[model samples]
Target: MTTRRLTLRQPVMDDAERIALYLNNFAVAGNLARVPYPYHLADARAWLRTWRPDKPAGETGFAIDLGGEGFIGQVGYHLDARGETVIGYWLAQPFWNRGIMSEAVAAAINWYFRVTAAPKIRSGVFHFNKASLAIQNKLGFIETGAGNLLCLARGEQVRHIDTELERSVWAERQDA
Candidate 1:
């Protein structure tokens, strides 16, 4: 899927270098639940090898490619252990505060809702990640709860604020 400033495409081997370059930064990896800090090219390669377009809905990902830049980040969703499909994303630190992630996430969510009958897309952020949480709020997500989540990069559980966006709400926002 294409946005005005991005091309959301399936990840490939060639993207490993860029992915690692961005994710290796502690600032980028610290907020994510799964990514380990000091992320390596090998880790990116292994992750890329797992991408499959045909995966069940809510279990797939897209490589976020900027217009001039190549792979800069990722936006996608996954089914949690509790059987909820929660959206997650991370952009290169250099691209922060530019509304790039907000746009990419909005487009990805639209595509996700289009392909599945899921009622809502769930998401959240670490308590201190106000920027990320703001992006979620901008896209119509609302706080649902709070708890602690394991951040692999941090190697510890951190306070988390849960959020959710319903399809109807997104549809209304799109029409606006």
Candidate 2:
């Protein structure tokens, strides 16, 4: 899938270095639930190797790429522990505030809804991650409830605001 400034493509081994470099930053990884602090190339390699073309949309993701920059970030969804389809994304710090993440996530989610029969996409942000929550809100996601999710970087549970975007709602937004 392609966006105005990004190409949502599959991640490659060559991207492992870039993924590790960006994800190593606490400012980026701290907000995420699964990424550990001081992220390493091995982690990126392992994560990259997990991707398979045959996997369902919920188990696969897109590598966000720019024309000049090879890999800037990632966008996709996965099944949570409870077996719900959940969308997630992260962009390099240098690309922050550029609307790049928002664009990439939008494209990914759009494609996800089109290709699957999922009723809605589940997601949320750590309480302190207001910027990420804003992106979800802009994409038609609404607060579902609250919970605690473990942040590997923080080494503890953090307050999370759960949200969801129904397929019907997404369809309405697209029509508008």
Candidate 3:
């Protein structure tokens, strides 16, 4: 998906170096619940291996690019046993607060709702990560509940806010 300032494409092994370079930063890893602290090249390589570009949908990840600058972040969804899609994303610290993520996420969500048959999209963010929460809210997600998750960067469990965007709500947003 191509936006005015960003492009979302399937991730490949060739993007590992850049992915590692950005994810290695604590600021980038800290907000994400799954990314390990001191993210390594090996981790990037392992993640890229999980990419299935040909898959029609479900749990597919994208590498976000900044026009000509190349990979700057990652976004995707995780499909659970019950067929709920949990959206997730992370951007390099250098690109923070630039509207890049907003654009990238909007594009990803639009594509997901367009192609996937899931009833709703689910997501959760650490309570302290206001920026992420705001992004999800701006995209029309509503608070569902709260819970705790093991944050790899913090190396402990942290309070989190769960949110979801049902297909009906998403359809309304699109119509508006």
Candidate 4:
């Protein structure tokens, strides 16, 4: 899916270097629970190869393009057993606080709900990550509960802060 400020496209093998740059940054990785710091080119290639497009079982990734500068960040969703779609995203430090990630996420959420038959979309932001929480709230997500143990690839435990947005609520927000 494409937006006025960003374009979402499938990640290519050549994008490994750029992906590695932002995914490995401590500043970026510190906010995200899944990606490991010092992310390498090999990890990017592995992720690209493993990410299946045809049978996307609720989990899908996109490269966020900021005009012609190439991939600036990534966003995607993972489906849970209860049919809720959980959204995740991160932006390069250079692109921080410019509303780029918010645009990318809003686009992704719209696409996810329109394409899939899910009843709701969910997202978790660490308590310290006020920027992300603000973006999610702006997109109509409401706080649902408290934190949980969100696991990371680097064997670190992240506090899973709360947020949820039902389809009905989202529809109402959009119509408003």
Writing each residue's lDDT as its tens digit, candidate 4 over 1-176 gives 78988889877788889999888877787788767667898888998897766746358878898986998888987765566678888899999989898889888878877887778878888777899999998999999887654545445666778788888887887789
Q: Please give the ranking of all candidate structures by lDDT, highest first, separated by commas.
A: 1, 2, 3, 4
lDDT of 3 by residue, 53-171 (tens): 78656678788999768999999988755677788999988889988888898899889988977788899799989999999999889999998888998899999999998888888
Better TM-score candidate (3, 4):
3
Using Cα atoms with residue i matched to residue i, what is each candidate's TM-score against the true structure?
A: 0.97, 0.98, 0.95, 0.91
Query: Model 1, 68-147: lDDT tens per residue?
Result: 88889999889989899999999999989889999999999989999889999999999999999999999999999999
Q: Model 3's lDDT to the true fold?
A: 0.88
Over 17-51, each residue of candidate 2 has an lDDT whose tens digit, in order, gives 99999999999999999999989999999999988
Q: Between the candidate structures 2 and 4, which one is better when assessed by TM-score?
A: 2
Off by over 4 Å in 2: none
Whole-model Cα lDDT of every candidate shown, in order: 0.93, 0.92, 0.88, 0.81
Q: Count the backbone clashes (under 3 Å) in each candidate.
A: 0, 0, 0, 0
In the predicted model 3, the residue pairs found to clash are none
TM-score, structure 2 vs. true? 0.98
Question: Model 4 off-target regions past 4 Å?
Answer: 80-83, 150-155
